[model samples]
Target: MQYAQLGRTGATVSRLVLGTMNFGPHTSEEDSFAIMDRALEQGVTFVDTANVYGGKDHRGRTEEIVGRWLARTGKRDEIVLATKVFGEMGPGKNDRGLSALNIRRAVDASLRRLQTDHIDLYQMHHVDRSAPWEEIWQAMDLLVAQGKISYVGSSNFAGWHIAQANETASRRGSLRLVSEQSLYNLLSRSIELEVLPAAEHYGLGVIPWSPLSGGKLGGRREDGVRRRAADRRHDPADLTEQLERWETFCEERDLTPGQAALAWLLHRPGVLGPIIGPRTMEQLDSAIEAVDIVLSEEDLAALDEIFPGPGGPAPEAYAW
Candidate 1:
């Protein structure tokens, strides 16, 4: 697998990141371990998880399983471990958000669960509008000084949120956010309007989540499987037509829909890598192969004709 520098940081990461959202929820412990083993063998060393993963009843079970794998294989140093905070982990009111108190408690909990002394990247799972950036960055800065987390990142944040947070860090001379994890796929290109540009302008690595649109672009509709629910902002019939055209386009290029979809994200500007959350070994293997499927200019034009993004970006996509 090819490795690229994560944003402006000196550290490099795999082109494909292994997401562990399904670790203990949809996949069993044995299967998760096998999938991770295969991933390392295939050279995918960037792994992402969250403190609120696992399942409804098994909140931290996923991290526990990953911790076990790390302990058994002694591969902790071989992987770039990433996890998220700002999610409710217990019954207390302070169990969530970016408040300094919650951040302090959350990092310790995550470290204990993952069986690691430091997290390579600790991200805010979502923007806490109520918490001031001063408190947030101060907490993260403390973690950095304590060698608890090396880098900070954000997930599911709006464009302005990235700017505001980074600006605050800049003023404070604290470590700014180095990466962003956003939902961007063949069916969901809304991030192009502002998020992608903000990330590029700030020199942040864009790690796209759900690059397959939750199986909508996986080519299952030909077998009569319905499209994963419509986005409400779009017409169902229009989306169905788009998917049909996309599937045909992939077939014409001799690519699986999943591969074509992933390749599109791989070639997008400002994208570091797309997170591949595979439940089984086969899925994992298929996702890794997408890195080699290069899309031509004509192929990208055809894709645009099928599922167009927000024209270009911001005002240029709308006004002058």
Candidate 2:
């Protein structure tokens, strides 16, 4: 497991983050435990989860699973644990959003479920449009002062949101957001339009989730069958052609499409690796192996031709 500083922070984290989204809903508790054990054993030290990952009825199930694993393994000190807030965790209106009240309640609930005193990184699951930056930062600043969380991050935020956030944090003398978890992959390049650039400019590490675009790039089976199309809604001719070209390129290079997908993110600038949410040990190993599959400049260019981004970034990507 290669290590890099999480954004500009001195605290180092594994390049390949072990996302635990599948722990409660998709994977059984026993399997989840085994996979986590294997992850730490292999040096995948950064783990990410959320308060609403356990499906509708079991909102905090994933955290409880992770907490139990921590207690059993006694490896709390060895791992960098991150989780999020700002979701409809209950029927009450206050049960959601980034209000200071909710933030306070949410962190304590997450800490209890996680069975840990302090979270390595606490992220906003989504931007709360209603919550003022001062209110949000005030709550977060209090948490930091109390040693409830070490750092703050964001997910599913746009470029300007990142700018507005850190600019506010800077004024308040806060460490601000150190990372941004966005949906990024070979197939999903929209983030390049603005999100990626903002994170880079703000000195926030980009941790890409859904790095395989929900298994669209999970690689074809040995029998040459696609588990699912990249996008079923509008499978345009161009997208079909791109998929064909991508498959052929991977075949010629003796690489699984999944590996190509992950390796592509690893090659990207400002990327702090990607979130690999493996449901099984084999899946975990495959993702770990992808970390070593280095893509050359030519290979990257070919991939760009297949899944071309928003051209480049901002005005240049559009106007010029």
**Decoy 2 TM-score against native:** 0.97
Which parts of model 2 have CA positions greater than 4 angstroms off?
A: 229-238
Task: Pick out the ten consecutive residues of candidate 2 with the lowest summed lDDT.
Answer: 229-238
Clashing residue pair totals per candidate (backbone < 3 A): 0, 0
CA-lDDT, candidates in order: 0.92, 0.92
lDDT by residue (108-145, candidate 2, tens digit) is: 99999999999999999999999999999999999999
lDDT (10s digit) by residue, model 1, range 1-320: 88899888999999899999989989999999999999999999899999999898979999999999999899999999999999899999999999999999999998999999999999999999899999999999999999999999999999999999999999999879999999998778999999999999988999999888776778865576865744444455667778888878987889999888889999999999999999999899999999999999999999888888889889799897
| Model 1: CA > 4 A from native | 221-237
Clashing pairs in 2: none
List per-candidate RMSD values in Å. Answer: 1.6, 1.5
